[model samples]
Target: MSRASRLLTLLQMLRGKSRPVTAATLASELEVSERTLYRDIAELTALGAPIYGEAGIGYVLRSGLFLPPLMLNADETEAVVLGLRYVDQRGDEELSKAAADAMAKIAAVLAPRPRTHCAIRPCCPARRATASPTTRCRSMCSARRSAFRPRC
Candidate 1:
Protein backbone atom coordinates (compact mmCIF):
# COMPACT_ATOMS: atom_id res chain seq x y z
CA MET A 1 0.00 0.00 0.00
CA SER A 2 1.03 3.57 -0.59
CA ARG A 3 2.04 5.81 2.30
CA ALA A 4 -1.19 7.73 2.08
CA SER A 5 -3.18 4.54 1.99
CA ARG A 6 -1.33 3.11 4.97
CA LEU A 7 -1.97 6.27 6.89
CA LEU A 8 -5.66 6.07 6.12
CA THR A 9 -5.69 2.49 7.29
CA LEU A 10 -4.02 3.50 10.49
CA LEU A 11 -6.68 6.12 11.06
CA GLN A 12 -9.36 3.54 10.56
CA MET A 13 -7.63 1.20 12.98
CA LEU A 14 -7.55 3.90 15.61
CA ARG A 15 -11.15 4.85 14.98
CA GLY A 16 -12.68 1.40 14.99
CA LYS A 17 -11.00 0.31 18.15
CA SER A 18 -12.67 1.16 21.47
CA ARG A 19 -9.35 1.20 23.37
CA PRO A 20 -5.82 2.38 22.83
CA VAL A 21 -3.80 0.45 20.29
CA THR A 22 -0.06 0.05 20.57
CA ALA A 23 2.33 0.47 17.64
CA ALA A 24 3.26 -3.20 17.88
CA THR A 25 -0.38 -4.25 17.68
CA LEU A 26 -0.96 -1.88 14.81
CA ALA A 27 2.10 -3.22 13.03
CA SER A 28 0.91 -6.79 13.48
CA GLU A 29 -2.53 -5.88 12.19
CA LEU A 30 -1.25 -3.94 9.19
CA GLU A 31 1.56 -6.40 8.55
CA VAL A 32 4.13 -3.64 8.76
CA SER A 33 7.07 -2.99 11.03
CA GLU A 34 6.66 -0.95 14.22
CA ARG A 35 8.88 1.82 12.83
CA THR A 36 6.81 1.96 9.71
CA LEU A 37 3.63 2.08 11.76
CA TYR A 38 4.97 5.01 13.76
CA ARG A 39 5.86 6.87 10.59
CA ASP A 40 2.46 6.19 9.14
CA ILE A 41 0.70 7.38 12.30
CA ALA A 42 2.79 10.54 12.37
CA GLU A 43 1.80 11.24 8.79
CA LEU A 44 -1.83 10.52 9.58
CA THR A 45 -1.82 13.01 12.44
CA ALA A 46 -0.23 15.54 10.13
CA LEU A 47 -3.08 14.84 7.72
CA GLY A 48 -5.67 15.43 10.45
CA ALA A 49 -6.62 11.84 11.19
CA PRO A 50 -7.05 12.63 14.91
CA ILE A 51 -4.88 9.71 16.04
CA TYR A 52 -3.84 10.29 19.63
CA GLY A 53 -1.32 8.23 21.58
CA GLU A 54 1.99 8.21 23.41
CA ALA A 55 4.92 5.87 23.96
CA GLY A 56 3.90 2.76 26.00
CA ILE A 57 0.32 4.06 26.03
CA GLY A 58 -1.61 2.86 22.99
CA TYR A 59 -3.74 5.15 20.83
CA VAL A 60 -7.37 6.16 21.23
CA LEU A 61 -9.66 8.25 19.07
CA ARG A 62 -10.83 11.31 20.93
CA SER A 63 -14.54 12.07 20.82
CA GLY A 64 -15.61 15.44 19.47
CA LEU A 65 -18.57 17.31 18.09
CA PHE A 66 -18.00 15.60 14.81
CA LEU A 67 -17.11 11.98 14.27
CA PRO A 68 -15.99 11.30 10.75
CA PRO A 69 -16.81 8.11 8.95
CA LEU A 70 -14.39 5.47 10.11
CA MET A 71 -12.13 4.52 7.22
CA LEU A 72 -11.55 0.82 6.71
CA ASN A 73 -8.19 -0.88 6.62
CA ALA A 74 -7.98 -4.17 4.77
CA ASP A 75 -8.62 -6.17 7.93
CA GLU A 76 -11.45 -3.88 8.93
CA THR A 77 -12.93 -4.15 5.51
CA GLU A 78 -12.86 -7.91 5.79
CA ALA A 79 -14.32 -7.76 9.26
CA VAL A 80 -17.16 -5.56 8.07
CA VAL A 81 -17.77 -7.79 5.13
CA LEU A 82 -17.89 -10.74 7.45
CA GLY A 83 -20.19 -8.97 9.88
CA LEU A 84 -22.51 -7.87 7.15
CA ARG A 85 -22.50 -11.37 5.81
CA TYR A 86 -23.55 -12.68 9.19
CA VAL A 87 -26.25 -10.05 9.45
CA ASP A 88 -27.48 -10.83 5.99
CA GLN A 89 -27.71 -14.50 6.80
CA ARG A 90 -29.47 -13.99 10.07
CA GLY A 91 -31.71 -11.11 9.07
CA ASP A 92 -34.97 -11.10 7.19
CA GLU A 93 -35.24 -10.69 3.43
CA GLU A 94 -35.60 -6.94 3.49
CA LEU A 95 -32.90 -6.51 6.08
CA SER A 96 -30.58 -8.89 4.28
CA LYS A 97 -31.05 -6.96 1.05
CA ALA A 98 -30.38 -3.74 2.87
CA ALA A 99 -27.17 -5.08 4.31
CA ALA A 100 -26.01 -6.26 0.92
CA ASP A 101 -26.84 -2.92 -0.62
CA ALA A 102 -24.96 -1.08 2.09
CA MET A 103 -21.88 -3.20 1.55
CA ALA A 104 -22.06 -2.56 -2.17
CA LYS A 105 -22.32 1.13 -1.52
CA ILE A 106 -19.27 1.04 0.72
CA ALA A 107 -17.28 -0.77 -1.95
CA ALA A 108 -18.35 1.68 -4.60
CA VAL A 109 -17.38 4.63 -2.47
CA LEU A 110 -13.98 3.17 -1.63
CA ALA A 111 -13.07 1.50 -4.89
CA PRO A 112 -10.86 3.10 -7.59
CA ARG A 113 -9.23 5.01 -4.77
CA PRO A 114 -5.61 4.81 -3.66
CA ARG A 115 -6.45 3.73 -0.10
CA THR A 116 -6.59 0.24 1.31
CA HIS A 117 -8.78 -1.76 -1.06
CA CYS A 118 -10.48 -5.09 -0.45
CA ALA A 119 -12.84 -6.81 -2.90
CA ILE A 120 -12.94 -10.43 -1.91
CA ARG A 121 -16.05 -11.66 -0.11
CA PRO A 122 -15.52 -13.07 3.34
CA CYS A 123 -16.28 -16.76 3.85
CA CYS A 124 -17.00 -16.91 7.54
CA PRO A 125 -20.08 -18.85 8.50
CA ALA A 126 -22.80 -16.91 10.25
CA ARG A 127 -24.60 -18.37 13.20
CA ARG A 128 -28.26 -17.74 13.83
CA ALA A 129 -29.43 -14.81 15.90
CA THR A 130 -32.76 -13.90 17.45
CA ALA A 131 -32.92 -10.13 17.19
CA SER A 132 -35.38 -8.76 14.67
CA PRO A 133 -34.08 -6.30 12.09
CA THR A 134 -36.51 -3.59 13.06
CA THR A 135 -35.58 -3.93 16.69
CA ARG A 136 -31.87 -3.89 15.96
CA CYS A 137 -32.14 -0.93 13.64
CA ARG A 138 -34.20 1.06 16.11
CA SER A 139 -31.81 0.28 18.94
CA MET A 140 -28.82 1.28 16.87
CA CYS A 141 -30.40 4.51 15.73
CA SER A 142 -31.36 5.36 19.27
CA ALA A 143 -27.89 4.59 20.53
CA ARG A 144 -26.27 6.80 17.93
CA ARG A 145 -28.51 9.70 18.80
CA SER A 146 -27.94 9.18 22.51
CA ALA A 147 -24.20 9.05 22.06
CA PHE A 148 -24.25 12.40 20.34
CA ARG A 149 -26.35 13.95 23.09
CA PRO A 150 -25.47 12.02 26.19
CA ARG A 151 -26.04 14.89 28.62
CA CYS A 152 -29.67 15.30 27.62
Candidate 2:
Protein backbone atom coordinates (compact mmCIF):
# COMPACT_ATOMS: atom_id res chain seq x y z
CA MET A 1 0.00 0.00 0.00
CA SER A 2 1.02 3.62 -0.43
CA ARG A 3 2.59 5.65 2.38
CA ALA A 4 -0.53 7.80 2.59
CA SER A 5 -2.69 4.69 2.99
CA ARG A 6 -0.32 3.36 5.62
CA LEU A 7 -0.48 6.65 7.49
CA LEU A 8 -4.29 6.62 7.41
CA THR A 9 -4.33 3.03 8.64
CA LEU A 10 -1.92 3.92 11.43
CA LEU A 11 -4.19 6.79 12.43
CA GLN A 12 -7.18 4.44 12.49
CA MET A 13 -5.26 2.00 14.68
CA LEU A 14 -4.24 4.76 17.07
CA ARG A 15 -7.79 6.08 17.20
CA GLY A 16 -9.16 2.61 18.02
CA LYS A 17 -7.01 2.17 21.11
CA SER A 18 -7.90 3.59 24.50
CA ARG A 19 -4.31 3.42 25.84
CA PRO A 20 -0.88 3.97 24.37
CA VAL A 21 0.35 1.18 22.07
CA THR A 22 4.05 0.54 21.98
CA ALA A 23 6.13 1.16 18.85
CA ALA A 24 7.00 -2.51 18.54
CA THR A 25 3.33 -3.48 18.45
CA LEU A 26 2.41 -0.79 15.97
CA ALA A 27 5.33 -1.63 13.68
CA SER A 28 4.42 -5.30 13.81
CA GLU A 29 0.80 -4.65 12.93
CA LEU A 30 1.62 -2.16 10.18
CA GLU A 31 4.24 -4.50 8.70
CA VAL A 32 6.80 -1.71 8.62
CA SER A 33 10.14 -1.15 10.29
CA GLU A 34 10.24 0.62 13.65
CA ARG A 35 12.19 3.42 11.98
CA THR A 36 9.60 3.70 9.23
CA LEU A 37 6.86 3.82 11.81
CA TYR A 38 8.68 6.58 13.66
CA ARG A 39 9.15 8.55 10.48
CA ASP A 40 5.52 8.12 9.50
CA ILE A 41 4.42 9.26 12.93
CA ALA A 42 6.60 12.35 12.64
CA GLU A 43 5.13 13.19 9.23
CA LEU A 44 1.60 12.78 10.55
CA THR A 45 2.32 15.04 13.51
CA ALA A 46 3.84 17.64 11.23
CA LEU A 47 0.60 17.63 9.27
CA GLY A 48 -1.31 18.57 12.46
CA ALA A 49 -3.02 15.22 12.84
CA PRO A 50 -3.35 15.55 16.64
CA ILE A 51 -1.17 12.47 17.20
CA TYR A 52 0.56 12.56 20.58
CA GLY A 53 3.34 10.29 21.82
CA GLU A 54 7.07 9.83 22.26
CA ALA A 55 9.53 7.26 20.82
CA GLY A 56 9.18 4.58 23.49
CA ILE A 57 5.66 5.36 24.68
CA GLY A 58 3.86 5.06 21.31
CA TYR A 59 1.08 7.27 19.99
CA VAL A 60 -2.55 8.33 20.33
CA LEU A 61 -4.80 10.53 18.24
CA ARG A 62 -6.46 13.04 20.51
CA SER A 63 -10.15 12.37 21.07
CA GLY A 64 -12.61 14.60 19.23
CA LEU A 65 -9.89 16.13 17.11
CA PHE A 66 -10.69 15.90 13.41
CA LEU A 67 -7.84 16.53 11.01
CA PRO A 68 -8.44 16.69 7.32
CA PRO A 69 -6.83 15.28 4.27
CA LEU A 70 -10.46 14.66 3.54
CA MET A 71 -10.77 12.11 0.77
CA LEU A 72 -13.65 13.09 -1.46
CA ASN A 73 -14.58 11.56 -4.80
CA ALA A 74 -15.01 13.76 -7.87
CA ASP A 75 -18.79 13.80 -7.55
CA GLU A 76 -18.58 14.66 -3.85
CA THR A 77 -16.12 17.44 -4.58
CA GLU A 78 -18.41 18.85 -7.25
CA ALA A 79 -21.37 18.76 -4.89
CA VAL A 80 -19.47 20.62 -2.19
CA VAL A 81 -18.15 23.22 -4.58
CA LEU A 82 -21.59 23.77 -6.03
CA GLY A 83 -23.16 24.07 -2.59
CA LEU A 84 -20.57 26.62 -1.50
CA ARG A 85 -21.09 28.62 -4.66
CA TYR A 86 -24.82 28.60 -4.09
CA VAL A 87 -24.31 29.89 -0.55
CA ASP A 88 -21.95 32.61 -1.73
CA GLN A 89 -24.52 33.86 -4.18
CA ARG A 90 -27.68 33.64 -2.09
CA GLY A 91 -26.62 34.01 1.53
CA ASP A 92 -26.34 37.37 3.28
CA GLU A 93 -23.01 39.24 3.21
CA GLU A 94 -21.49 37.61 6.34
CA LEU A 95 -22.73 34.16 5.36
CA SER A 96 -21.49 34.61 1.78
CA LYS A 97 -18.02 35.57 3.10
CA ALA A 98 -18.00 32.56 5.41
CA ALA A 99 -18.89 30.29 2.52
CA ALA A 100 -16.06 31.69 0.43
CA ASP A 101 -13.61 31.17 3.28
CA ALA A 102 -14.80 27.61 3.72
CA MET A 103 -14.34 26.92 0.01
CA ALA A 104 -10.76 28.22 0.25
CA LYS A 105 -9.99 25.95 3.20
CA ILE A 106 -11.34 22.93 1.33
CA ALA A 107 -9.43 23.90 -1.79
CA ALA A 108 -6.17 24.16 0.18
CA VAL A 109 -6.24 20.43 1.04
CA LEU A 110 -7.21 19.28 -2.44
CA ALA A 111 -4.60 18.22 -5.00
CA PRO A 112 -3.43 20.96 -7.38
CA ARG A 113 -5.19 19.55 -10.44
CA PRO A 114 -8.43 18.78 -8.60
CA ARG A 115 -8.42 22.22 -6.96
CA THR A 116 -9.59 23.72 -10.24
CA HIS A 117 -12.86 21.85 -9.81
CA CYS A 118 -13.73 24.14 -6.92
CA ALA A 119 -13.57 27.41 -8.86
CA ILE A 120 -16.65 29.53 -8.16
CA ARG A 121 -19.33 29.25 -10.80
CA PRO A 122 -23.04 29.88 -11.01
CA CYS A 123 -24.97 26.86 -9.67
CA CYS A 124 -28.04 28.30 -8.02
CA PRO A 125 -31.41 27.49 -9.52
CA ALA A 126 -33.55 30.38 -10.82
CA ARG A 127 -34.66 32.48 -7.85
CA ARG A 128 -38.31 32.57 -6.82
CA ALA A 129 -40.14 35.85 -6.98
CA THR A 130 -41.30 36.03 -3.33
CA ALA A 131 -38.21 34.64 -1.49
CA SER A 132 -35.46 37.21 -0.90
CA PRO A 133 -31.78 36.23 -0.69
CA THR A 134 -31.91 36.05 3.11
CA THR A 135 -35.03 33.94 2.95
CA ARG A 136 -33.42 31.57 0.48
CA CYS A 137 -30.36 31.34 2.73
CA ARG A 138 -32.47 30.49 5.77
CA SER A 139 -34.40 27.88 3.81
CA MET A 140 -31.20 26.23 2.60
CA CYS A 141 -29.69 26.24 6.08
CA SER A 142 -32.81 24.70 7.59
CA ALA A 143 -32.96 22.04 4.93
CA ARG A 144 -29.33 21.07 5.55
CA ARG A 145 -29.84 21.00 9.30
CA SER A 146 -32.85 18.75 9.00
CA ALA A 147 -31.19 16.47 6.52
CA PHE A 148 -28.21 15.93 8.83
CA ARG A 149 -30.15 15.68 12.08
CA PRO A 150 -29.48 12.47 14.00
CA ARG A 151 -32.24 9.93 13.83
CA CYS A 152 -32.97 7.70 16.78
Best by lDDT: 2
Compute each candidate's TM-score over C-alphas: 0.46, 0.43
> lDDT of each structure?
0.62, 0.74
In terms of lDDT, the poorest run of 10 residues in model 2 is: 143-152
Best candidate, TM-score: 1
Mind giving the per-residue lDDT tens digits that candidate 1 earns over 1-152?
A: 88768776666666456579888999998999998887887776676656779889898765441243446765566556656765676789999877776664465345343123323433334222777887766765554333233131
Off by over 4 Å in 1: 65-152
Question: After aligning candidate 1 to the native by TM-score, how far in Å is the CA of 101 from where it should be?
Answer: 15
lDDT of 2: 0.74
User: Candidate 2, 11: how far from true, in Å?
Assistant: 0.6
